[model samples]
Target chain A: MFFRLTFSSIRHYAFRFSLAVLGLAISVASLVYFLSFGEGARRLIRRSVEDFNLQLLVLPPAQSLTVQPLLPRSLADSIRSLGVGKVYSILRLPYTAGFPPRAMGVVFGRDFSSSLRFISRYEVVRGRDLRDSTVREAVVGEALAKALGWDVGDTLTVGTGRYIVVGVVKAGSPMVDNAVIVPLNLLMEDMGTDRLLAVAVAPPPGKTEEVLSLLKREFPGYTIQTSEELVKLAKSFVALGDAIRFGLSSIALFVTAVLLFAIMAITVQERRWEFAVLRALGATRWFIFRLILAQALTVSFVGWLFGASLGWGLAEVTSRVMVEKFGLDLVEVSPSILILALLVSLGVGLVGSLFPALSAVRMDVREGLGR
Target chain B: MSRLVAESLRKTYGRKAKTVAVDGFSYTFEPGRSYAIVGPSGSGKTTLLYLLSGIEVPDSGKVLYGDTDLTAMGEDARSRFRARYFSFVFQQFHLIPYLNAYENVSVGLYLKTGKTDHGRAVSLLRSLGIEDPNRKPYEYSGGEQQRIAIARALITEPRVIFADEPTGNLDSKNSEMIFRILTGLASEGRTVIIATHDLALAEMCDVVLRLRDGKLVGS
Candidate 1:
């Protein structure tokens, strides 16, 4: 019965089936559009946290923290005592070239092993890693290297004084790969700040929160955080992100749903007598219902397939466009997002088809046939 | 047991001073026989078929298909009963215009597994004297469309087939052709009940039921 009903529906080729699937696909795409950035950020943060090997990141409350470079400082040693694999202070300061200043640069300083955690993604494309801090030494990002034009053994004025070129590294992330690395004390001397910005700690696997909870309990004045917390903070940013994406995609999906409803309503209306005839021919109300359901499912599935792939592609294009136009990082959209979108579209199609399918059932086949 | 039985069946449209369409009707239609109800407009033949076929519930009394009271069933049960027990043809030919002849046949076979062979559909249509196999109802002549409708009814292999004024839309020449096909079904032992006023159809049937003012008066 499902077989013949399918054939009958296909024979009708009402186009709504394809349209529905397409609508669903687009909805899926809308979902992708809405969630892709968050997905990418989520991925990148996990990578960074893994690279940092820091079990903890302690800082001030997010609202009070204002330096775009360094998060707020915390008591570094208390966190280190709490079964941490290791602990280190991280510092970032704004540096300019001349005695007066020629160009601006962000100078990040830490213990070489510790700094490597935050910048773990980088690979030395040329030169070497940062050496001991008594002598001014620096490791530049590949792009920063290109900009400064100093190779191995060349001296470049880093903050107030000259530093020897050490190793250049490439972290995969564009954000990190573009940064300059220097030894911890020089960064403090360069910034003239005694307070370290934040402390990063590494602990045993899966004990991240257990450690942060302890640090938060031990040191109440300084805001204590971790990579997981940072990821959580970044993830919280997605509430706003999701709201914006949902707002945009809902408009498109709402239109798709309404359009699907209207088209199906019209098609059902047009087929009144056909339904009537089916009823007259001994089709029970259930049979009539199945017919409409079959039609709706057929249309919605086709629409979803088209809409998901097309919408995903559209999302990809839109992300690319944003990248070129504004240099904004739109995250990688997931297949699940597309699948989710498709599911939403199907839901919309199912909801939209309800009234018309009932209408088909209610029509009098005898009167319909009389006409 | 007869294929169809109506025992004192009655149907009235309104509540106060209601309009009665079928009143106090009792009839028994047997298998392997053809019966036609003859009546003028508003004489209740079509309504009576509607009641017996379980498309409409009778206001009073029972329509029994082998002891199952159709009027006792709910919408879903009646519909299921209808799907398995009978097929219908109608005056307007009521063929799905969007579907071709073969596709039209498939509609009648809904939800029935192995009812997929279009070979039987094509053969049946051809047997009914339809020459063009691929045309939809609108493209076919009224006679051909009616033939397709008949073929649709047969495709389900229902126990009984009901048709409301099966040839009412056709010319007498085409009408005679439809009669032959219907009579042939009866000869094959499938009960056929056709609601009509065409005496030519009535004279050929195994029984003729005469309806007047919503009552079965003469037979």
Candidate 2:
């Protein structure tokens, strides 16, 4: 009978109850959508870090606020002479490298043998790998090829010279998938400099820290970092993104609670006479209180179910947009998110109905009837 | 059934300018008899009913039911006592708007016990000539709604029934039917107390008490 009365009352004020439900749904959906962006960024960074194969990176220390110091050829030789591990020097230069001179894209000049030895799974999907006989041959990553519409044997312009695309590689990382790769000597001749940006060193297994300390000791003016340290540095950049997501979710929940409180307050005010009738007919104050709470819970439960489904759908659309516009692989919607959303909605329901329930319990039966 | 006794019951309303609705009024009502509290407007008839039924506490008085001091009990205990010993029918036919006639009758029973007797509820509504138990209060006519309210009051089978103008909103035919129902309860050895201005209905009771300006003038 209690349940019947609660449901009947809700049905009596269906429009008012529906507005509360809609408010909760929108709040939950906004929370899910905001958190999804954080999840996407974390996944993208983690994938990139995994693809790098835990190699130690060595870079020239910054010389000025706006200028990054470059590694000369002599420094590269000195690092190679240490024989602590296999070293691969890479020179990254920004250039317009498409058929119609598109905006800046990275051109990587690397030692072919050492790069292949350190970076595993650098497979050539089409044509052949870079060889000694082909001086101006280049290998474009999957994303770069797709963006420029280039296939094997197509000529890609880099600065003043054009290199024939001899291979299309799939590196399984967004950073590598959007780059153009060429030989170190060819790139040095084209750029008129022998300075490199960084050196990737794959130390013998279990000798990572040993090589790291040795490199820092020998090259005092350079920065040395292990792959784990690089990953930690990247994660630091995403902390602000996480804080923004938290702020957005908090604001959404606040708005939802306020909306629910307003609607429920008005509902209780409108039904004071009805509640007083129940009280006059042998209903205890506790019964009236619980009935109001039950009504709020019913609305919140239905709203949460609908909100979770809407949030999932919206998350999928957001993931697709991120992948298309930013080349990020972030399309995962975890069950924990849905569970959290439901819990938040339930909490909102409880908090929002507290004052209204109290008012119902404290109503004056005579005054209410008189009204 | 239990006899009701009130001793010098005093009640007042408002803080700034006090109005004594019931002042030093006392009466004793016997069981198994019908009594009418007849008075003009502002004669404290409804306030006297509320005090006797344990719905409101008096300012300085004692109301007893067969030697049990109802005025000394706590509000929660009084509510339980009221549920077990008394039933009420108001002038406004205060039926829950959301509930159907059948559900409205079952509310009192459900509150006392955690269960409802649907069969008894349906039989009571049928006996009251309410054919459709599924119709809400607003869907019914004034007389039907009054009948539904009476059914709800009778569902608990209390020792005493207090009604404040139970037929005020009904037509002449419905008023006679309601008066007959109250008289029939008295014949069945249950106490019935009604407050109304209708002298025709008042004359049908076994005893009549008249009040003016919150004080009893005739009996």
Highest DockQ scorer? 1
Going through the candidates in order, their DockQ values are 0.56, 0.52
Per-residue CA lDDT of model 2 for A115-206, tens digit only, reads 43443556788998778624898988776687667899999877557899999988777666766888877787777787877777888889
- Pairs clashing in candidate 2? none
Error at A110, model 1, angstroms: 3.0
* lDDT per residue (tens digit) for residues B1-219 in model 1: 256888999998867988999889988889999898998999988888888888888889999988898888887688777778788888888777666788887767763433567788889888888777787779988988999988888887888888888898999999988888887788777899988888977788888888999998898
lDDT per model, in order?
Answer: 0.72, 0.81
Q: Name the candidate that leads on TM-score.
A: 1
TM-score of structure candidate 2: 0.81
RMSD of 2: 4.5
DockQ of 2: 0.52
CAPRI rating of model 1 = medium
TM-score of decoy 1: 0.85
DockQ for candidate 1: 0.56
TM-score for each predicted model, relative to the true structure: 0.85, 0.81
Worst 10 residues of 2 chain B by lDDT: B74-83
